[model samples]
Target: MALRMKVTYLDGREEVVTILPPIFMAAEKHFKRDGGLSERNKVASTYYMTWQALQKFGREENDFDAFLELIEEIEDAEDEAEDPTGPAPQPDESSS
Candidate 1:
């Protein structure tokens, strides 16, 4: 199954976009950084991912450094159309 991303912008918009191959490559390349999550690498990786998302789904085409500044967060997209918490259990009424 294809993975999806939940992109939250600083302006409070959340979009769930598919992580297809091309989009994923741009982010994954830098994400494989060997520095073990240094603060600098973290920022860089976030920049790349946000930029790639903007290029793919957004109207941006050039260097999206400024757009990266507008992102709040990015993470795996959960199924918003369904209840992930599931339903509560039912009691046995046949004992009555």
Candidate 2:
């Protein structure tokens, strides 16, 4: 799935643009490469890189719903791989 960013101009105009996931994935890989850094620092650096890249691509904000879905999918896939019998987590009722 393509990672998308919503760009809003100074004049209040907005547009959605695709940002290659590999870019963010690369930042994560880099963070993992250096195990010496504190976990907080690694996570912060990765997110910082993500934001910088979004700005470089002219994105104003992230599509939070899509991001959450992506995270859920990844977690589900990992769970399936690790334990086939594991049930997926239920969505929060309050969110509905």
Candidate 3:
């Protein structure tokens, strides 16, 4: 499954990109490895994953630091989206 996420760059720019399954899987593996998500590994995986995902969409990111920043924001956004804060109640609009 491809994960479509909006990434915000350090320059305050935003982009919607779909991360392919292979890249996502590889990043997941690296994130959940034996060391349990070290900073170095996380940065590496995010950078590589972002690079691959962008390339798949015909985008190029040359600044390593900027790429790292963008991926970190993407990760943060992903975490927020996956928060188990309970689902919101639906409105009863049927009577309208």
Best by lDDT: 1
Look at candidate 2 and tell me the lDDT of residue 58: 61
**Overall lDDT per candidate, in order of appearance:** 0.64, 0.46, 0.63
Q: Looking at model 3, which ten-residue stretch has the lowest summed lDDT?
A: 75-84
Give the Cα error of residue 66 in candidate 3, in Å: 4.9
Per-candidate count of clashing residue pairs (backbone under 3 Å): 0, 0, 0
Candidate 3 lDDT tens digits, 3-96: 5666666777766566778877766776675564367676566556766677667775556555675543664344334435668889999979
lDDT, candidate 2, at 2: 42
For candidate 2, the lDDT comes to 0.46
Instruction: Indicate whether candidate 1 or candidate 2 has the larger lDDT.
Output: 1
The local distance difference test score of model 1 is 0.64
Q: Residue by residue across 1-96, what tens digits does model 2's lDDT show? A: 444444344455534444356665656666675653356675455344445455556653555344333221111121122234668898899977
**Model 1 Cα shift for residue 91 (angstroms):** 30
Tell me each candidate's RMSD, in Å, in order.
7.7, 13.4, 8.2
> Candidate 1 — which residues are off by over 4 angstroms?
28-47, 59-62, 81-96
Give the C-alpha miss distance for residue 54 in model 2, angstroms.
6.3
